[model samples]
Target: MSSTAEEKTVMKVAEEEVINESRRNFLKSMAFLSAVFAFSGILGIVRALGPIQMKIPEWPRIKVANIKDLKEKEPIIFNYPLENTPNILVKLGKRVTNGVGPDEDIVAYSQICQHLGCMVRFMPAGSSSEFPDRNLFYCPCHAGFYDADDGAKILAGPPLYPLPPVKLEYDSSTGDIYAVGMGPPVIFGKGPPGSTEVWRDLVGGKLVGGG
Candidate 1:
């Protein structure tokens, strides 16, 4: 072949190769822009959906006892927001967590056992052979013990969760003690085992008449 003709053919092939390369780059750019747009659209949709709303039920304020009337290490039995649910209000005689009143020794907790649907009895310090040094709640059915001075902590037995403590409020002017709310880990059989959904305690039973 003539040199001039061969040179012309090489130039044509190089021009076509460059044009093909430019087309591939353009397609790649378009694909990337389309993916970005799709991702942004998904994000916008999620934002438009907003967040979930949960309306918690109002806690009832029910008067349980008089702090002055309570004796040291003694328990006052009463039904709280739930008419069927029994609880214990006590003067531990020493300050503790979530305790109320002038001494900060007055506290309360649900009597329901965390292991099973059994009632627990209040045991003053030295009352139990297993845990004599601590004021505790002893479940007669399964022998589950809860620390009374503490936040009803599970000491031993099959109970998977801590006993739900009653949220107490004290009236200094009248020396009155009120049952206001409940703590976490829910109530026995009220929700999932060891759940923190305390709102479930309000359900499955009727609220007491008044504060």
Candidate 2:
């Protein structure tokens, strides 16, 4: 082949190689940019969704009954913190620790049994031959018994914990009985029993603590 033809052919091959390299680099850069934009868009979407917030429950001060009308050892059924939650108010007729009322003998407790959420009934003193001295709160479903006097302690039964005690406040002039708060053994849920989870679950959402 002639020298000029050879030179022309070499120059043409070099130019073509450079053009191919340039095209490859341009494609690689575009692919990288596309990947970065897609990643950025995904991050923006996640940020827009925000973080998860858990809801905690709260209790409210509730009026339960009139002190003058409550009979000793007899319970008045009521709800506390929320509607449809069962509770019992009893007049013990004798002073006991952590008891509240005009005579410091009255007490209140949640009726929900700890064993399996069964309802507990009030049993007056001497009502049960097995437990003769003091009044008792009895759960029939699992034979759970709670002392009516001492914060409804787990007396003799399958209950691993005591009944949740309802804190009380009495109006001397108005004769009205108020449930101020709840004590331990709150009720099982996402949080520990009697923990904030109980209140949160009871209210069915995030609750700002209040009366």
Top TM-score prediction, candidate number: 1
lDDT of 2 by residue, 1-211 (tens): 9999999999999999999999999999999999999999999998999976766444666678887788877789987755656788888889986677768998888888888889999998888887888789999998888888777888888888888888888898998988877776555343565563355446553222332
RMSD of each: 6.9, 8.3
Candidate lDDT values, in order: 0.85, 0.79
Instruction: Give the per-residue lDDT digits (tens) of candidate 1, residues 34-123.
Output: 999999999999899997666667788888888768999878889876777899888998998778999899988888887767999998
Q: In candidate 2, which residue ranges exceed 4 Å CA deviation?
A: 1-58, 188-190, 193-198, 205-211
User: What is the TM-score of each predicted model, taking all chains together?
Assistant: 0.72, 0.67
By lDDT, who's the top model here? 1
Model 1 ranges with Cα > 4 A deviation: 1-55
The TM-score that candidate 1 achieves is 0.72
